[model samples]
Target: MPIDIKQFKEASRPLSERVLGFLKDHPEQAYSLMELMAELEGKADAASMAWIVAIERMSGKKEGSATLNKYSKALEELLKQGKVTEAQLQGTTYYAYGGGHP
Candidate 1:
């Protein structure tokens, strides 16, 4: 069945937020797309999964391949806007808050 865009947007909100939060907590370390997806799957809804698949298809990529690319892009934008910083991490590459350690 085709997924509704509005529902997808709603579902994606928390997933995106989670992704950003993870990045903010672990700035220096890199993660595979699969790893991130695995982490996301634990908490995301079907709509969130749809977005992940869409991004994966658009990138012509597999799990964990483009994970950092997407993450870096989001982080770069946030950094540029002064909403976040690279100094947030001490040395960790992965972080989970309330969602459990990844």
Candidate 2:
């Protein structure tokens, strides 16, 4: 399941596959949840996107980005299957390639 960046950007492939492709390409680099969301979505900054969601919820009483939630769920699925590693730094979770069972 070697999904290219284009496929991930266009959402032509499953979220899990797209995530794996990115992790594999980056080797051992750890990416935070928001970082992964930005990569998978081809956005330059996911924090800002999250801020938008926050503003919308606070002012407009609207829901956050569903796609970002989908990415989190997909990552959890990968985590449960031992396909990726999870770590916490400064209280924020980060994900890396391999070693999930540890």
Candidate 3:
């Protein structure tokens, strides 16, 4: 469901702030955008980002984890930037570490 109008009233702020406001108003819920961010984001060093990617791989137990929609988001981000490189052979995605192209 979309955020209520009252929620959007407070959503004009930056994303972290908007999420904060949303959580404050509705502490019982969770949202997708919140899960989409990699831990530490830009602050993470290369090694750390790789570790996070591994963790996300191992720990994905959410409803969308098994769906193409969820993995597509991850594939998009990886295609953009990450220690993990992706390549498709036939229909399967293959991943490997290091700066080399997959």
Q: Find the candidate with the highest lDDT and give its number.
A: 2
Candidate 1 residue-wise lDDT, 1-102, digit = tens? 887896577557744466666655776644434455555555355456547667777886655436445655654555465544343245533332322233
The Cα local distance difference test for each model comes to: 0.53, 0.77, 0.42
lDDT string, candidate 2, 3-96, tens digits: 9796656587688877877887797699988888877766778786677556656674444556666878888988888888899999999988
Query: Weakest 10 consecutive residues, lDDT, candidate 1?
Result: 93-102
Off by over 4 Å in 2: 1-10, 55-64, 99-102
Point to the candidate with the largest TM-score. Answer: 2
Residue-level lDDT of model 3, residues 1-102, one tens digit each, is 887886576545543333333333443433232232322133245455446555666786564333334434644554465533455666645443324232
Q: What TM-score does structure 1 among the candidates reach? A: 0.35
| Candidate 1: residue 14 Cα off by (Å) | 12
Ranking by lDDT: 2, 1, 3
Q: How many residue pairs clash in each candidate?
A: 4, 0, 0
**What TM-score, over all chains together, does every model reach?**
0.35, 0.74, 0.27
Alpha-carbon RMSD to native, per candidate? 9.2, 5.2, 14.6
Clashing pairs in 3: none
RMSD of 2: 5.2
lDDT for model 1: 0.53
Task: Tell me the lDDT of candidate 3.
Answer: 0.42
